[model samples]
Target: MLRRARIGLALGGGAARGWAHIGVLQTLTEAGLAPDIVAGTSIGAVAGGCYVAGKLPELEEFALSLTKRRVFGFLDFNFNGSGLITGKRLCGELDDHLRPVQIENLERKFVAVATEYGTGHEIWLSKGRLVSAMHASYALPGIFSPVNINGRWLMDGALVNPIPVSVCRALGAQVVIAVNLNRDIFGRGTIVPDHEATDEGPQGLEDLARARSSR
Candidate 1:
């Protein structure tokens, strides 16, 4: 008399619109569908990490409070011209909520994806430093600073595997459920890959979120 296993739960990134994860997770909870392997990119990484770490409630609260002002508070908004998202303020906020909960100590098995810009390799994070991995996964190239953990510069995981079904499948998760919050945000003659010249501004991102939410 043993229960079955659910393979994967994929979360998508959508900046401020990541709040939709709250709703989706709520439904999943009601349905009693707990995924064994979880994966996500960008803000989606935040959702997946917090969920696997048993801190979804706090993450939901944090996502709900992401007003324009509050979101800006977690940026590298310095007049001295600093790195993009060089601020640890965002991670600090996550720590404040998910304190006492480490990534490896979670109850569920989790996976996070990060892309190596130098080698074009996809770094799948199923183990090792949790907080650092979360920070690297969410650090949107030009929007946030790159994470140099032990000399490895890592940015957003979505740069490569936005929908990490393959990663989850690789980790032995045969059944995958992917929740994409960043559908249609880019890759259509918009938001060029070059960070500095791209046009995924706050307004544009918010608009994308709203549009997705409506649909």
Candidate 2:
């Protein structure tokens, strides 16, 4: 469906760009699917701000730079900690799951997808290992860090976290879809199922083995 949408936009002279974090918002608006109320998680807040402020033209570049800074912060923090940073994989997975759930469970949960920035999700999740562990065990990637007194994660675009403006007033904020980007690189050591051994990150038979062992 996304591919089709992208193709349709491209065919119709619409600019279709792929973004890791803020791109989701860009694509939505570019495709003329803007939400009535906008809420962003972590770096996504920048995109939200752009949308609300009528700064669509600058959103793409802003998001790119913001994400670059975020990745840099992840790298910087990784050296001092467990040497694992960058919430790309985790955030990517959460975005995948939340896309469907948001439409389905919008009334019950305020789904927000966050990414790593200056402080990295590792440091954030460290504050609540139990919650982090729960997310990890369920394969639901997310940084289990609670927002500060203001209920916000610090990142680029500005220091203070901004409250999301709802496109629809009826749906109140209830759930946040957090994306955690912290963990040791298990490398080829991790296993997969129903496949031969290979130099891949927990693929094939090894992946299944790890899943079973976790059980």
Candidate 3:
């Protein structure tokens, strides 16, 4: 009997900075690596959803063709003043891309994380409408609109756990490979040129996310 390779993929969140995921995923596939399980947060869900839907190549194309505007659309203010992001466009995109695609129908197990804003609890949904789970995963507070799932309000998973490689491990993946796209390799914060004309790097988004969770 041929032994099967148990592989798991963990994806990270990064607002509009998920283009790297497309490249990384393509590289892994080209190298003959197949994941038996997938885990993701925020933009990672978009990429993960495509993979689960068996549309990796299409996802690559989508990432390459992905514009800053389209990615930023998730952060734009909607007709509803409370949420900075309007769910219509984001949900529409999910519907258009992952049509007729079910998570349970995927070649591999899929998991996406979401956080309940009320209690700041992590809700990992392994079974449900793939796109709906993804929508909740990418719901970045103050950026993307909150998603209502089963009467629970959820925001981006990154706010709670940006990396959930352990989730895949717990699910029985023999080998785990996680991709983190939110990392600023150089640790260089954003610089602002004020009247002083000097570089002033403000806090990173992750820090802001932490602040929000505390409140």
- Over the stretch 171-199, how does candidate 3's per-residue lDDT look in tens digits? 88889888887662211112111001011
Write the number of the candidate with greater lDDT, choosing between 1 and 2. 1
Quality of model 2 by C-alpha lDDT: 0.28
lDDT values of the candidates? Answer: 0.67, 0.28, 0.70
Quote the positional error of residue 138 for candidate 1 in Å.
1.0
Model 1: how far residue 66 lies from native, Å = 2.9
For candidate 2, write residues 1-215 as lDDT tens digits. 33321110100000112134355545665786635334333334323333444444555554456565554553322333322443434334334323222122232222122222343321111112121211222221222222221122322111121222221122332332221122211111111111211112322333545677999
- lDDT tens per residue, model 1, 1-215: 97576668888777767778878877988999888888777777788888777778988777677789977666656444335557588777877766555555677767666665566556555545566677777777767777765445667888777777766776678789887776543211112111111112222323543665698
Q: Number of clashes in every candidate structure?
A: 3, 17, 0
TM-score of 1: 0.77
Query: Where does candidate 1 clash, by residue pair?
Result: 84-144, 84-145, 85-144
Residue 140's C-alpha lDDT in candidate 1?
Answer: 76
Q: Candidate 1: global Cα-lDDT? A: 0.67
In model 2, the worst 10-residue window by lDDT is: 6-15
How do these models rank on lDDT, best leading?
A: 3, 1, 2
